[model samples]
Target: MISYCVFDAYGTLFDVHSAASKFQRILGNKQESVSALWRQKQLEYTWLRSLMGRYVSFDQVTADALQYSLQVHGFQEDSSKVNLLEAYKKLDCYEDVQSCLNQLRANNVATAILSNGTLPSLKTLVENANVAHLFDQLISVSEVEVYKPHPSAYDLVTRKAQIPKEKVAFISSNCWDAIGAANFGFQVFWLNRNENVPDVLPGKFTTIYNLNQLLDKVVQPS
Candidate 1:
């Protein structure tokens, strides 16, 4: 039986696109999509930095991505504007994420958030969402200075959760993350909210449409 559920934070628990929307609306001019570009660059920089061993906290990486995204997208730099754009760090949860989390918690199953987010951002998110008390643990890859898709990150989770991988069902909206955790021996569940094709990875896997599907899969009988 899966007694523990581990989740990813950004695109998984929180809508990461909120930051870009705030940016675009604030800037008030863009022939281009600032949100998309910022998100793309943030992921790109994360992977590149992780591979290069030039690790910074997720908050720093996000700021750097935003600054460069501004230059590339032709948005003028205003310190206040840049700080507001970093509002992704303060982004709230999706429509009823607390309900899903509460469902798991009420069942006596342990739940955690495993993400690349830094302390300040994750703290604000849990507090603002009023779901901080629901989480048994909040694990961050920032602790290990490596991003997701790296086995060590998942290992950090397994170590921290103190639960064997098989008993913990790992859930990620990112297909690659589900793949990574599976390879690391967790019972991985993919939340394919985007309806996109599953990218190839080491572990063969199963998917669900959203948290409800995941609940059906794990909480319901096998």
Candidate 2:
């Protein structure tokens, strides 16, 4: 039985691509590519920084990724970068987020957001989406000066909640994240919204198409 439900904030609860989507007027046909590269670079930078023992806030990493995307795509305007970054601060939550969280809360499940995000950005994101009150805690890897997939990053949950890893259900849209949590001993759920093939990682995790399935999986027995 799971006592706490921990979720990844960026792609799990919020739509990270929505930042670039908001600038469709300028990006036109380039929006998807831009968003993809930005996200790819963002994750790369996090892992790179973590390994190098050089830590920076997610905000800085996000800005750096956006800048790289803009440059690669030939978007020379600083205003374009500013607009995307500003839009990112208030990323729209996924459609199923509120309902799923509400159901979990109604069931008396302890809920938290465990992310690579900085605390301020996480707070602003949930608050802007009007779902701030739904979470019991908004946890950030920034607290440990590292990013996800690191053992220390996963340890934050155990430290804060005082729950055994076996009794926590960790959810993430990213396969690596789910793998990391599972390796750390949480019963992990991967929200496979993109229908991508599962990674060849060693840890076990359940994959679901949407939050509705996720809610059913976590709240009900296997």
Candidate 3:
């Protein structure tokens, strides 16, 4: 039986697109492209930094990713970049988040967030979304000095909750992150919100279309 439900913050619990969506007036037609590229670069930087043994905080990675996106899109890097980062600090929570979290809490299952986001950023995010009370913990990869897809990053859940990986059901919308948690021995649940194709990563995981489906797939103790 699962004792803890550890969720990934960005893209899973929080809508990363909300950052770009907030500035649609300024971005015009390039809003979606800019948001997609920013996220892609953010994930790439984390993996690259981890492999190179040069760890940086997610804050730095986020800024660099935004800068890269601005450059590639030929957008002005003046006030636009600043505005975008500010918008990202308080990303909107997904529609299904509250009901799912409420269900987990009602079932007496511990819930915590596992994210590449920094502590301050995560705090600002959940608080802004008014879902801060739902989590028993807000874990960041900052604790381990690396980002997700790394074993050490996944190890944070075990350390914080003091539970065996098997008893913790890990949830993430990112395919790579779900694969990482699965490889680390958590009962992995991939919130495939986008209906995208799954990665060929070598780890076992269950895919769900939404967060509400989680309780049905992951059984609670009697």
Candidate 4:
């Protein structure tokens, strides 16, 4: 049985694009592109920094990514960046998150968040969303000074929870993160909310459309 259900925070439990969506009036038709580039660059920076052994908090990486995205789209307003960054601290949790988390708790499965987000950001996000009570822990990659897709980051879960990798059900909306957890020997589930094609990665994971499907896969029949 899977004793713990470990989740990826951004884009999985919370909507990463919601920050940009909040400023849609200012962004106009560029909203979607800006959000996409910001998310893409954010992930790229984490991977690059991990490999280069230059670790920085996820907050800084997020700011840098947002700046790059805004500059690329010819958006020079300092207030736009400030407002968006502030908006990020309170990102909207996905519609399915609450129901899924409640069900997991009812089923006696322990829950946690293992993400690239820092501890303060994660705490603010869950508290803002009012789902802070549902999680047993909110883990940050900062504990290991690295980000996802790195073996050490995944190890944090096993170490902190005192659960073996095989007994954990790791879920991520990001294909790379799912792959990384799977490679680390967890029973991985890919929450493919956008119906996008899978990444051409070496690790193996089961794909599900939403969090509801996760209960069926991981919860043992009683």
Q: Candidate 4, residues 130-217: lDDT per residue as tens digits?
A: 9999999999999999999999999999999998999999999999999999999999999999999999989989999999999999
State, as a TM-score between 0 and 1, how close model 2 is to the true structure.
Answer: 0.97
What's model 1's TM-score? 0.91
**Deviation in Å, model 4, residue 157 alpha carbon:** 0.4
lDDT of 1 by residue, 99-213 (tens): 8888888777889989888766788888877879989888888889999888888988778877778898898888878898888888888888889899866785778877877
Displacement of residue 38 (Cα, Å) in model 3 is 0.4
Candidate 2 runs further than 4 Å off: 220-222
In model 4, the runs with Cα more than 4 Å from the true position are none
The C-alpha lDDT values of all candidates are: 0.80, 0.92, 0.91, 0.95
| Candidate 3, 23-49: lDDT as tens digits | 889899999999999999999999999
Best-fitting candidate, scored by TM-score: 4
Q: 1-222 in candidate 2: lDDT tens per residue?
A: 777999999999999999999899999999999999999999999999999999999999999998999999999859998899999999989999989999988887889999999999999999899999999998999989989899999999999998888889999999999999988999999999999999998999999889988777778643
The RMSD of every model to the true structure, in order and in angstroms, is: 2.1, 1.4, 1.1, 0.7
**Model 1, residue 13: what's the lDDT?**
81
Q: What lDDT does model 2 reach?
A: 0.92
TM-score of each candidate structure, all chains considered together: 0.91, 0.97, 0.97, 0.98
